[model samples]
Target chain A: MNLLSIVLYPLISSLLIRMWGGKNPKLAGWLGCVSIVLSFVVTVKVGLHFFINSSLEPISHNLLTWAILPSHAILFSLKMDVLSFVMSLLITGVGLLIHIYSLGYMKKKEYGRYFSYLNLFIALMLLLVLSDQLLMMFIGWEGVGFCSFLLIGFHFESHKNMNAAKKAFVVNRIGDLGIFLAMMIILAVLVQEKQLWSLAFEDIRTHLDLFLTKSIFGMSLATVLCLLLFIGVCGKSAQLPLYIWLPDAMAGPTPVSALIHAASMVTAGIYLMCRLSFLFDVSHFASEVVMWVGIITALFGSTVAIFQRDIKKVLAFSTVSQLGYMTLACGVGAYAVAMFHVVVHGAFKALLFLCAGAVIKASQGNQDVYQMGGLYKDLPWTHAMFWVGALSLSGFFPFAGFFSKDLILSHVHEHHLFVFVLAMIGVLLTSFYIFRLLYLVFYSGKKRDLPGYITPWVMKAPMIVLAFLAIALGFLWTPSFLGSIDLFPQWMSSLYMIPFSTHSLWFEIGLSLLALLFSAVGLIAARKLFVHGPIADQWIKEKFPKLYQLLLHQYYIEEFYYKTFVHDGPPSNRKLSQDTAFTNSLFHFISVIKGMFDRYVIDGLVHWFAWIPQFLGSIYARIQDGQIQTYIRWITMASLIVLFYWFLWVSGMIA
Target chain B: MNQLFCLESYLVISSFLFVIGLIIVLTKNNAIQIIIGIELIFNAAALNFVAFSYFRPHVTEGMQLSGQIFAIFVIVIAAADACAALAIILSLFRVFKTTRIQNINRLRG
Candidate 1:
């Protein structure tokens, strides 16, 4: 398969669907599915070829020369080594399943538009992962962000959803600025060093020594570059400060949440870090910053997830937290471990979201978990799949997340004890929140009567496949003690040459046991508190109203942001009257000045220019009176005066 | 030279005709009288052109009749103009029941 076709298939189908599939939604949905399936098949073919030839060189094909400069040319190229192969497989594979799920999930009227956006999103994400150059990757990066905004505001009828989509777009743009600056700085440094200007990952790696030795603003250029890149990472992956968009991004359709937010697009940051692992490997300070930021975000997200009432919001925050773990792994220079966690988390998080979608559908779009209970019997398949997802997410033994998360925790343990402790707390919170959600939604008995909505087989099939992955994907990278090959890490090790920090079998087992213990503790605690229903929540809410409000309001971070940046002025309840009075007067003075300037300076100038034409037109109006004889008399008199003056001048030859 | 055929005599006659035409156009109330005054002014200009061509001191052999040709072109244009002006006056008479210039001032600004 031509690698470019992997990106093209979905893009062409998106345009085709938009052009032809407007009236027949079924055909549109099938078209979208078939294109993604073809892309997936191509990815699998590439993967199989790589598997058969383990020592095969990273496959690179330049589709065309995108730009030619005096020094070098920028090629629109694709590369499929182990990293791109893994990510391509994940994007196309999960993307295909989500497209199928969307068939049953989306309304008929929206089928064409929704599938077009989904396919465009898949195409962009494949482009993001497969592109060999950073410039091409950035294009894919922005394209996916745009697609996310479109899909999030798919229901444009609601102002709230539109606001959420705008928020996501604007926030991602803030991170995108960081990436833009980083690219400029890279190009500038290359030019300054008299090196060929190339942004391909391989080229950057080959010239990594140039960046490491240089300094910008009294800091290592590599550190600055990596830190700037991390800002982009923070935005796309929904880490600290920039993570506000992801939770609100739940306004999108559930399949969008499953595919873009949870499975594929959100992990692009991790993929980028892994792709450029060579650059990051040099900057210890930047790596520390990455690690700490990840830790805080992990804790923040899991804690916020615990308090969220909306099922999708909870999954959204859990995705944020899991993304934090992957970032943290990348920070520790364990790019392989991060990639492992990325693939596993993509599978289970997508499964979890799909299950949540089924529940929300069954409840007729009631996302509030408080309103749902005892759904196991009604939605047996969804319930079972949710359990698989929740267990995998919470790092239960032998599940996908257990292997990946434990790998991350062990790597963090080797790096720093404090980080390891914080990560353990994050693990406990992860288990607590996910189980709290699971129990609240499914195990609290019947909270109220729900409309009996059957889960369609179309939705059921994807969930079934995902649940199997969530259960068995752990075997792909089992610890040595399990006597299984660590296939995922070995596959990734070729791309990320960082040596794995090895430990004894007993030490590894101890760490896994400790993580399992935390998981169990969180589960038992959730069962104890939430098994009965809202009584425990009511008691807690009454006992600690302030704390409850804090958690419920997401630590008031969104509110703080709104007040500080979005609000025009201080609220009316001011503590300092004198200060408030002065500021108010100052604002009034500025406004008055602005009003006067607008009235006199800007509008007055325009009016003054307009008056010229009006004044001349009024004077000229008298001559256009309709009497033809009067006009003839004026012309004859004027011509007589000119003739007399000319005769006198010509007689004397006057100058 | 005969006084009636001299260039000065022809110039004086045409100028006098032009002045009279101007007076008629300025004082006329009837639309037909104004049309007649315009035709007079055109004939005065054509008469001057023919006088200049006939009396020129350095008239070339091929260009000796150019002034007469211009006079012929002016006479043809004046005839077409008279026809169009008379048609307009006839339409005006239908609309207002009179051809007086002052009464047909509907196009005044």
Candidate 2:
């Protein structure tokens, strides 16, 4: 409920990692889950009050003031509303499920550390959503980003996973730079207009217009700040060029993938977009850019997903595409639609990942679709549950995805038909390819071998629960829960200001049928081609060579980075040699220049300056010397210089 | 806000202390000298805060709060940092029986 408990949940989790008490993995997992469940309960209670009544009774006071400047106080601020509360639910509730699933998923090796890292991640995510000030949120933001790096590289003994985690951290760091820049820019604008600096979201929003009117080094600083902040979003949410790290992030534990990619970290970008939806509304060009980026990411992600061999990798790319949909909602000025997409996508994406985790276990870690065929007979329950998830993902009618995805497509249509057409194609590609994935892995009709480990209760329980949410969330929009929130008397009672009901029952039913049609058509096409043999696969390659290869290589975004950045960065694998050689040569050349100056130029100048001092010194040395002859010679020179000076003065040569 | 800036002006002593710490950090060859430099910087910050409190009488918490918090941050960081430095010193002692930075090139080729 407060900052202590908010941070304590994860801190306690980290302690459990070492509290292995002789290394019982089950005990460690239970301890981690217990702590997470408690945090979830507390946050849920706080969230219930927030949603029912849109008031958090913010506790306000400066935790500590600047030593020399009291006005520059660092206040401990905490409050709750629909948005943070919902995020709290996702962070804690979905977090609890992932924690439980990890018990089974991470049964191998040092699971104590894995659970500990996962718990820390959950805690930091809570802090990010719950904190009141931008500075506090930044701490939580960076904290979670760090935890993501930790969890993603939990198998750091392996080089590829470790590098993937590093890449993720570095990419997010670049985005975070944008966040820092935006904060600095915001501070500058606020100070210039009001003669004060504030990081409180409410206070900054109050000075929004004044900030827009100000200039920064001849640039419209508001646009700069917004774009910079979007860069941060782009990194986390995996939009366009910045999304290369996510599919590789699948190298971590599947639960980690579900938690980070599906449920929490990736959505942070969308949350940020929605949080600053008010600022974005003021910039038409920026919003349009957000829209276009979303479309490209959606199409790009879905196309790549179609060709991915690894089960989790396909779902990984799917998340990037889905997040693009949420971002698309933000771009089209339908922030609520974006938020809605986040909820639906979180539920179904997490379900799909967990289900994929189960199937991978069932198939004895053979996640490649080419290795999997007709697993439906062995794991019927998993198959059915996986169907619910895959259908929901494909936007089948009467499921969660249909309501959210169609709302986005309809909103885009209202704005512009071209955007709508892009979203429609995105919808079609998503439906076709997700079904393609489902058919390839599960429904190909050829008998496949399955492992016995999938029968474990630990594995199937969370899948069942997620499957229900995936099925039932669509019904929440049917007018019952809308009236329940007394304090927040709006439909869907979310933090964002948008319509709860955007379309009629007719549109909802019609879209559901159409999605079913698309899914069925895709399923049939895949079954007709791939259910029997390798012919369909060969045909696909032969028919669509360039497109298939492009999709297979993720559009060569990695290749671009490889050519321009990494390979060139340490050229020809000659780093140490080049570094030592360059440093020695440059320093040597400088010394040679210094040597010439010391011998010729500097020595000549010093000798000239020293002449006067020497003449005076020789006369002074005549007063006291090591030898009498040397002293007499110095006296003779001094007398000669004095006579010359007197002659010049008397003869008027001084003029 | 007015008192805040006045306090900043009086806080030059803390800035001077920090500068001295920086010089010691740079010029000292001994690890302990660098440690001492860090402490000097911390003291400078503490003194700066106390000065601000004196300047801004109406702002009661100005100096005391920051001085105490900064002292804690410094103390905590210093403890951890000192442990790391001491470990390096111990390893160096084992290798060379001396704490000279010039001779601690076993880490280099």
Candidate maximizing DockQ: 1
TM-score (all chains, Cα) for each model? 0.83, 0.71
How well is each residue in A1-655 modelled by candidate 2, as lDDT tens digits? Answer: 3545755776777676757722777677777888888888777665566436655543332443333357655465665556776677778877888888887877655677887788888877877777666777788789888888987888799887888899899888988999999988787677667766567777767777876777666656667777888998999899987898898788888888998878898998888877777788777777888999999899888889877878888898889999988998898888876777787777888888888888887787777887887877877887888889988988876678866776677677667779777777777778767777777777776776555554567777887888888877665443222232223223233445554444665665565456556656765665576666335656778998988788888887776565444533222234433443444565667778989989889898988898989999988765664443344446657877999999999999996
Candidate 1 displacement at residue A129 in angstroms: 0.5
- The CAPRI class of candidate 2 is incorrect
Candidate 1 pairs with clashing backbones: none
Measured with C-alpha atoms, the lDDT of residue A358 in candidate 2 is 82
- CAPRI accuracy category, model 1: medium
Tens digits of per-residue lDDT, candidate 1, A213-251, equal 989788899999999999999999999989989998999
- Candidate 1, residue A565: Cα displacement in angstroms equals 3.6
Per-candidate DockQ values are: 0.54, 0.01
Residue A211's C-alpha lDDT in candidate 2?
62
What TM-score does model 1 score on chain A?
0.89
Residue A233 local lDDT, model 1: 96
Question: lDDT of all the models against the reference?
Answer: 0.88, 0.74
